[model samples]
Target: MVPAAVLALASLLPVQSSAAQNHAQPDQPAKALARSILQQLIEINTTDSAGSVSATSKAMEQRLLDGGFAKEDIFLGGPTDRKQNLVVRYRGTGQKKPVLFLCHEDVVEARREDWTTDPFRLIEKDGYFYGRGTQDMKDNDAILVTAFLLLKKEGYRPDRDLILALTADEEGGSSNGVDWLLKTHRSLIGDPAFVINPDGGGVDLQNGRAISVDMDATEKLYADFQLRTTNPGGHSSLPVPDNAIYHLADALERLQHYTFPAELNAVTRAYFEKLSTIEHGQRAEDIRAILKPSPDALAIARLSAVSPEWNSILHTTCVATRLLAGHANNALPQTAQANVNCRILPGHSREETRQALIRIVADAAVSVRYVDDAGNVHDTAPESKGFPPPPLTPEVIAPLEKLAATMWPGAPVIPTMATGASDSVYTEALGMPSYGISGIALETNDVRAHGKDERLPVSSYYRGLQFYYEYVKMLSGGQ
Candidate 1:
């Protein structure tokens, strides 16, 4: 027998009738519009060093205006002349609060030399869309823009408002668009029923087969630390044992050999448990062994060695991302510095990680300092843990399940945490429940968001486009 409270909660959520379950997927016009928007966005450089995200925002705002949205409903503003954010709202019947669809327009810096094709140009060859933001997500930006336009064309009003926010500097910068908006213009974004972010979460595919539809229920904390050592310079012919470069290099070598202890929270523990059921043979056994109270050392080592994804899930990871030294070749370096980037697990604090790094380095000569987003260096960091993950309410999960059943029949929807991070950090920080759910599917081996030759399969892009349209309709109680 079900409890009375459980039944009451179930009755509050809107149920999808058989008639409401189906809708036209991405038709020809929708595909063309999405493709055009994506190409335009790609060709316009939004990189941190040289690109103008402010211009990109204005261009999108014009598109919305041309599509019949009033000039008053669209907003464009940010901290600076080059970095701007766009917020557009679609009116509704006022039955519920708005749903915020947050996507960042800025992408990681891409160079022409690093990729086979120009990273700035949208090239479709061999069944894939090759571009910088194709995978790390201009695709979702285009998808959401197209969905709103199509809805307006159909004259379909929903039970609640739908808001889309395209912003700057999610990849890397001081003036984060989401942070600026929340601080300066919370009234525009307004209160939301919830936030659906497409910056993370994806369909996991292995060997071209659907493994699971993963949702980023939570994410690791991002922190960067600077390691520095200084000493008196000397001529290359007169070398000394006490050298800055040697000290810094030795500390980094120790860091390379060491790994953080295995730590798992509620989300990751459940992730491994669900993953064990899908994975088979020796791999499955290793996962099960690691879940034990005293997990086997060999199993942890073997699994962590083979997959970086599993390694990140199981432990806090820190690696040296940038290094600088040697002002002159003829003289000993007076100073040396390196940037150690870390993704800390949820329970640990940034300060705690810094303290651990100091211990691992075991050298007083090499000083560790915390580096903030603004490039400010400090000796200490905050003791607070990462944002607590919100409960997976039925209202959020039900629609996802219903849609996934029709699209990928055998795939299970699994809740997992992001190994890296996204702009969801800004919204979730405000106590607004944010979830990362994108319909795009990519192969596990071909995962290359920030790497060379970043591409999304042509079929996958269109399918994801269709999925977001149907998904928003299902969430908003639209026909």
Candidate 2:
């Protein structure tokens, strides 16, 4: 729950629309270009298996080269030859530091058998664009590329250098695109004012109407813990009381009843404060109550139980994602393991959660260990004591609020912390403040990112294109 004093910083004023006046509606040619780039990206198999990120990187590199970008300003390489990243610089007048527009080109694997339509092909049906990367992020990749091309064609020079990075392996792989870039090619992406990641923030829609524009300033840390219990093997016909499978089951049951204490930070505090105004009935009341100096504990509990998203936002969440038992069904289980995936609260340490899990399990025989392929236990970010999240500076917030008001009047712009992780963590760790401000809006209930039949609304796609085009211009001092 949030504190009432935090609401004092909330600003509901609309920003003057000077950039909007300067920008014109996206014409047919621009629309066609955006669609073409999006379709090309979606059709290229960028999945982990049976797909090569190098192919997509090469294609995008060619597009920039053909668009009059200097060969030196463009870079396409990665730790591995197969997993490549593309970094392009749109030089400005050097009046201010560079601003990075970052997005991942790799997408979650989508099988043909799992989707009703070809997941790799961009298809427009029922007022929606159905595809794998439509929502999880090729949409933003296309929009950013389209904006870059349009800006170049129109001769709209920015006040500062604008860097566009389309990286690989955000979904899951040994060669993470952003990590590789930071380690190998840090100079390619210069020190920036801040990063605007379209992968994070968006408008939340309900009943086809805009509710709020969520601007993600921070995200939870992702960590996986392996819980294992081992015992001597025996024949199944002579079952023993001290069985590995039974001990593992007991630990899991205890974990199911355990819940981390609800914690709040600046981003989450402001989130609940603004959301309280829009939500109705008891939920709204509970939200408001939680913001008070003396918050109602019962109300917090009630709200936490209502939705999984709500629970995650309020607390550090751990759930068993995978399980393994005996080698053979006929033999007593010699070993059992469970993969407990946890999305830790920002500024919290993975070791703290690991300790908590061990304490909760309360079994000396059960071993809890952080699972990392590299075996580097120190890879997790150290925990900070208080709410040490990145601030929502006026430079970033003003434009976003103004744009949200311009696009969907009356909708409040709220800063949020993502329960899921993103590549932004890498940049933030490198001392550049990163934000998720993707202009694409989606229905909150129907978000199919990383799921089967992922899609985005047709109207939303075009709106996002226009929003980003103007927003980038504004950020670059166009008005």
Candidate 3:
């Protein structure tokens, strides 16, 4: 399913000359290769409509093959045709278990009309790379590929094999890339010591300077519940108190007033402990108070109400996203439905969240039920419970902390819990400790991962390249 234009572009890519390959300083060549790969990926329109992940995977597959990788070490298949994943292994001496590098090839849909320039085209302007996946990812994918190829060229042997999985549909669609790979091709990844995912972690910056390298060791659980109310249809003039839309509205109002209790885990505790040092005044005081064995109730309420992000990190959150009611303009609706999305904390059960919703609504006419990933409605609880947050073991954090000091100098490496979800959830669920360390730095106010005009600073992109290059080398025992 590779697009003809992408393949044509791939065929036209300039080959690295012998002189450039032989140069003692390989940083230039590696950066060029990374840029080339990133541009090609961005231009392919890998959205669900105009582009194919299979195409992107094949393009990267060809790059590795051209760099002298054996065909057998590279895998290009997924559950579906257009949604194929690419897994490449760079074999080592087998002194240790393999290390996995994961990045999704799929991106959120972007329309040409919504962007200042073409979303599918990589435009370098104002010292930034403007595109949909530039900041969300694709930058990490390019860096990983470039590093692998450069290391191969250098003949740097590792104590363990390094596996790279460029996957599809991590941005909300059918057939998640990581889920499919885990269920179908677990052996390809093998039982690695842990996984390095660049999807969740990032360097938080202020005024173009890094404050800290945030490593997300855990993520909130994503679950959806459908709130529905049914009533007999009636004429507009004969509206009754038992209207479905009104019942649903009242339930949602009650939910808006409800808030989950504040709690803290190891990751959040560390996050606040570090964050408190940088903040001042009441905000800093509130952060420190929350870290106490018994947090101040007033401080928790003040902090939670002041910021939605703080609220999400402190407690599970459920909010109505989509609503549907009347079939006709002039008729009382026979049914009303609302989709309530919840980001539950680790160890929380889907059943527990659903039951809480039922209690909050407290309406016999309003029924709450779980909605499966495929949009199927089910009255029963999920068969599987939410996975607990992974422990921040020394094996993962030590190298990260050491490298963060070397790379950014004085920027504290903070353990974080992602309010958003990532493919790491699937790997962690399979008992493989997964950590999100995208190795890219982003200003806190400048994140546009799924939004329009998404971009990454030109300098930050290269910094990420160097960061991951060394980090991967150290972890893989090439240093």
Candidate 4:
């Protein structure tokens, strides 16, 4: 009962054999190298733990040395003792400024018991390689390293010096990683024409399909502040006008009620305008209205209600995460504190956000302060040698998108604005246009990132190998 056109299309497709499916190699040597590197990485417990990076760095250093990278070029960057950073450089012909590939070797803590397999051991089942750092970053690091080593092995030189930085402690802040490296090793990344941090930006959603070609040109700001209040302590039996907890609750209520002004920036405007053309009906009209210079509140309201993913694109959002104050069950607490985190659109300053928060609380008793001060704003540079994402070029994205299309036909390329942050923050802070690009392919609805049983399909690992090999070759001005 299949339609004639469908049958005809199926007939035209080349039959893929079982062996081809099982042992499919996209650039066999590169695939083997990337997979091998990843397995070694997963084996090391490189969290913020005591001995994490030492072992991991040693393994990576040995690998680089075996590939013939100069021992001096593989020195560590960070505090002398614990897990530190790793840097590798590949010399190229002096035709252009070098393209710096930024990567972080640290990962978030993973609970051993919560996982179906040993999170530190790379487990392959039904074509998926499951491990702790599979998605959030190891996949990115693996490809870049493989590409660097391959170029070296082939004796191919790039137009500019290729600098590869793998830093530590990104799961926390750059305290131990890029922060230290940038401050101490400025000469290493200083002369680069532009840089690419694969930590932000992604494909955009179009119609019911995702446009896989879009890349994040910018990222929202991150601000974490505390809402604190103090009041007179008394016995539980005595009534008070407003207790610490009560004041905090009232402030939370007001914050939840008030919505920040929604202003679509240039990047988001371009994003939606492109999507509207590909979508249909109300969805299309809604997108069109949202992109207008002066979008109506109704349009904003509708879009915000659609998804947190979409709401983030339009307005700044605040959420109360932690609370502390009460001491004993029967005793009245003297002070109470609530933690509020906000993700503001790019170009919004942390100071502006802090002031807005003060106004929102509007309570005489409460005082506010920030928890992490990693500078919540991106410092954009003009006349940089690249496109909208200055340091990250259209040159790089073009090839990456082409790779994605070739690897997964029918998968749309949608430029994305990531809600979460990554080590790319360090590169961005250095005024390098950084992005979070990877070679993994996921179904439209799969959510494997930073989750238990985290995994990447075996095909994705191999495809990434090929893409990076091609990418490095092109960037280096090679064949």
Candidate 5:
């Protein structure tokens, strides 16, 4: 449920924002509303730092209600005031599968000491909005809500219904938000033809180029593994050669030494081939040759020659992120544990990764246990052909691709794989084809997502608002 504080305050504001809505033209009013609402939301501490989400949910709910959504169409069902999920619906003509535009509301804690301005408040400087969740991704939320509200006010009945979910705890697991919704409120999210999450996109090849549309048809599944070694608890005064610390360290070292086999499936192959076409000079030739079957040696040579970030995309990676051992400085500790986060590429399973780890460690002294099994695994013959790639139905992709061509020509539209996860995982798991499209036209240098002083380019955010309107119209028209 929404927090009393937010609801009480919302009850006092004008129930209908028609006064502000009437000030702008119908075509541009949605974008204006998006900007206005985003500025208001930036004022709230939506971060879970306070361990409560009622305030944020209420603010969001009120914003939607005032924007034109019916009160019953908005929902708030979750644990308590600390974490509440928001769902708002817009009516449409019953002609196509309803489209679901998903995003999260909760943001990671921003370090005030590290930021130039208060991260909680919107700081407009030099045309950009400096605030947390601007890119990762309050901008998308604002644009989406604006699109729905304006469509409702204009009485534009879409061919398909529009369902909007502003989930909680996306930075954490989905246990509180999407996961619960899918399980408990399945009917609310009708069997969608597909979903569009505005989290994944490609860097522009150059300035003023069409932002490469990186449609993530596939993503790496994460499996967390814990490595532990036990030794007798003894005084620090009496040191042993094979103590828990040393054993755990050796296991980590071994893990570092061994690398999971790099397997390029159809998606990666298609991705690189497209990259090969637009990329210039030597890089293009090397990339093109790597797409050929039996190009392992050539691919490895080329990948290793490039940056580590690029290398990771060509392979499965494992990194030890958390280490746990002794509690007291004086104690040597009887047990030591390390948490290894592994990102397994497509065509592999958690079990296969586990077995690979066992081979790497090759030590009986250290035991491996999985913390969370995120995906199911199945064994298939290495030579057997797998399912064909997801069909790019023109009905869903044409407008998006056209926009890309218009915005960025000859930019090599590639079907890329997301190294990180997104809310699309839920829709994809539900058997609906999903696309992650963010209209933000960004270069490769921008990096503040889940980092210090996150900011969004003013042009990109505004353009995204336009993109949403165009996309909704195209899909609803079946163009």
Candidate 6:
């Protein structure tokens, strides 16, 4: 669905860019600049537990300053001194409204003992860059920074103003950067036509070959439920079947076995429609059958059996993530609790999912309650669904399609829903559509973000650098 406006914007002439630097070729300095920026960011600890996000924000601010951006165009502020967000405006000819680009500065906590190499240090070995944020993000941060600097240095003018926001607390915390900026510094990032987020979607590769260039159109809502039961304690030797542990365990088992009904929205349907064209044989047949007025039950079963992703896309998933039961090994558990995390499909509220879980457990003794990020327990969950997805306008989709075809020849661009969540939740709630457009490619099996030995392919980082360079230009009306 290419917007008619995109085709018309190309005919406009390029005026003198506001903050043009020294004349330099776009391609020559991009690779080196990207690597340096990524290395600096990776080594800096921006984790919520033992790092300062504002440190990285300042470092990045220095990079833009050196690239000749006016100091007035850049602003740094957040909820706290330790967690600051960086927002920079790349001035254009003002032919159109601004476009906001968002990425987070925080990475999940990584321990040295868990990773083979230092998680904070960028170690390039065996064709990969191993670091905490390599896959989860920082790589895209480098890509975006490099693109802005390169474009600025090359004097490339755009038709619309471009806003770049590298913020903090996206991983998890009370001081969320996106929510804060939109609340406190509204003018810093004015209402953009739409947003481009590098947090979720990109090229999905299998066995070193590109499979699908996924554009995350929407994502599932994230919610956590606390399942608990309490009973009178007894000695281990006198354990009873009606104990707290048994009741809680039984409830969790029921939830594990129960599957939510199959659901699909326009984005997911379009995802499979485009994917079916790229697949072959029985896999292809199964995908096509799922699109019929009455999707074949056998087809859903087959696809769900082979791919966890397809299964998640077809259904809302809730699983026990953590459990705490019993005070000591020698005593019967007096209280037992398990945490159930659910990724609800769009069009469903948190309260609706909580009610569904209560029904699935079907035990009056076991209580289901919503848990907030700050660990507060509530009697009920929110009755609101995730912000509705906006239309897939042409101005956004067309440029990515054109660039993706050129970069990854066979990888077709398909709009897929993110099974997980990102900070785009805040902006999307404001009615500005956000599309996940990370040009970084990753193998299906090698995704290690927030886990041990998180890494990104060596070549993938460089390709991402080029992707944003051309992509930002194309969408902003650059020649």
TM-score of each: 0.93, 0.91, 0.90, 0.85, 0.85, 0.91
The model with the greater lDDT, 1 or 4, is 1
Report lDDT per candidate: 0.85, 0.83, 0.82, 0.68, 0.69, 0.84
Model 4's TM-score against the true structure: 0.85
Q: Score candidate 6 by lDDT.
A: 0.84
Candidate 3, residue 109: how far the Cα is off, in Å? 2.1
Quality of model 3 by C-alpha lDDT: 0.82
Regions more than 4 Å wrong, model 1 = 1-25
lDDT by residue (236-301, candidate 4, tens digit) is: 888687799999899889998989888776666766776676666776687788776678778778
User: Which parts of model 3 have CA positions greater than 4 angstroms off?
Assistant: 1-26, 49-51
Native-to-model Cα distance after best TM-score fit, residue 187 in candidate 3, in Å: 1.5
**Poorest 10 consecutive residues by lDDT, candidate 6:** 1-10
Tens-digit lDDT track for model 1 on 1-479? 00110111222223434432333357788889989999999889999899999988998998899898989899999999999899999998989889999999999999899899999999999999999999988999988998889888898898999999999998888889999999999999888989999987877665455556778888999999999999888899999999999999999999999999997778888877876765667877998999999898899988788677778888899999999997999999999999999999988899999999999999999999999888899999878788867788777889998888777655667788888888888888888888899988787668788899999998788889888988899889955
Q: What is the lDDT of residue 394 in candidate 2?
A: 86
lDDT of 6 by residue, 303-404 (tens): 877777788888899999899988999998889999999999999999999999999999998999999766789999989897667789999999999887
Q: What is the lDDT of residue 63 in candidate 1?
A: 88
**How many residue pairs clash in all the candidates, one count each?**
0, 0, 0, 22, 3, 2
Per residue, candidate 2 scores C-alpha lDDT tens digits across 36-124 of 99999999988877788888889989988898899999999988887999999999999989999888999998989999999999999
| Model 3 lDDT per residue over 242-266, tens place | 8899999999999999999888887
Pairs with backbone N, CA or C atoms under 3 Å apart (clashes), candidate 5 = 52-82, 53-82, 210-408
Candidate 2 matches the true fold with a TM-score of 0.91
Best by lDDT: 1
As for TM-score, the candidate ahead, 4 or 6, is 6
The CA lDDT at 101 in model 4 is 77
Off by over 4 Å in 4: 1-24, 27-29, 49-51, 174-176, 201-211, 237-241, 373-393, 409-414
Comparing 1 and 3 on lDDT, the stronger one = 1
